[model samples]
Target: MAVELDPQLMDILACPSDDHAPLRAGTPTDPDADVLTCTSCGRGFPVVDGIPVLLLDEAIPPADSASTSRAGD
Candidate 1:
């Protein structure tokens, strides 16, 4: 599913790993990417279905294999 961001929500959202100030909407890895990143923590949060999966277990480090959130699968 594709995640949509609310203009109001974007200003308040911050990285879970670290506040890192406001998160940037797009990264070099992706332009249409729904993930937002914390420059300080280096953790990326992927927003899906208009909800941000902020849980450490739910979030996966950017991978090359596929866009699977399973870190230990």
Candidate 2:
């Protein structure tokens, strides 16, 4: 199921990185896939079961195809 995040919450959400840029919502191809991307760093944070996993440890680094491809592993 897709989790619809509140616009107000989205507005307040910012990247936790040094850049602190605003997050962009992902356009999921699947119902269960949702993410928030940092505009400055290009890091991706997964959203599971309607909650965004915003932890820095859980973030996907920018331009890392290997990490993204192996995400399911």
Candidate 3:
């Protein structure tokens, strides 16, 4: 089930990536509607059991990003 986060919490939440971009909740039509998407990096952080998993390793990067590695990687 898709988790609904509080507006206040959402406001404080940001992507864990180096960009530290703002996050937007996934739309209902999205396959990963339970995720929180980074506005800048296009990575999706999963929300599990009402808790957001903001770990970079757990984040799903954008499809196009798979072909490219980060600067250090």
Find the candidate with the highest TM-score and give its number.
3
RMSD, every candidate, angstroms: 5.2, 4.6, 4.3
Q: What would the per-residue lDDT of candidate 2 be over residues 9-28, giving only the tens digit for each residue?
A: 99989999887999878633
lDDT of 1 by residue, 1-73 (tens): 2346888887888776645456666554675677776555556677776677777676556554344545458
Model 3 Cα lDDT, one tens digit per residue, 8-55: 999999998788998988833485489988889888889998899999
Which residue window of length 10 is worst by lDDT in model 1?
62-71
lDDT of 2 at 69: 72
Q: Please identify model 3 stretches exceeding 4 Å from their true place.
A: 27-32, 67-73
> In model 2, which range of ten residues has the least summed lDDT?
24-33
- Per-model tally of clashing residue pairs: 0, 0, 0
| Runs with alpha carbons beyond 4 Å of true place in candidate 2 | 1-3, 27-33, 64-73
Which pairs in model 1 have colliding backbones?
Answer: none
The local lDDT score (0 to 100) that residue 2 gets in candidate 2 is: 44
Q: Model 1's lDDT to the true fold?
A: 0.64
Q: What's the lDDT for candidate 3? A: 0.83
Clash pairs detected, candidate 3:
none
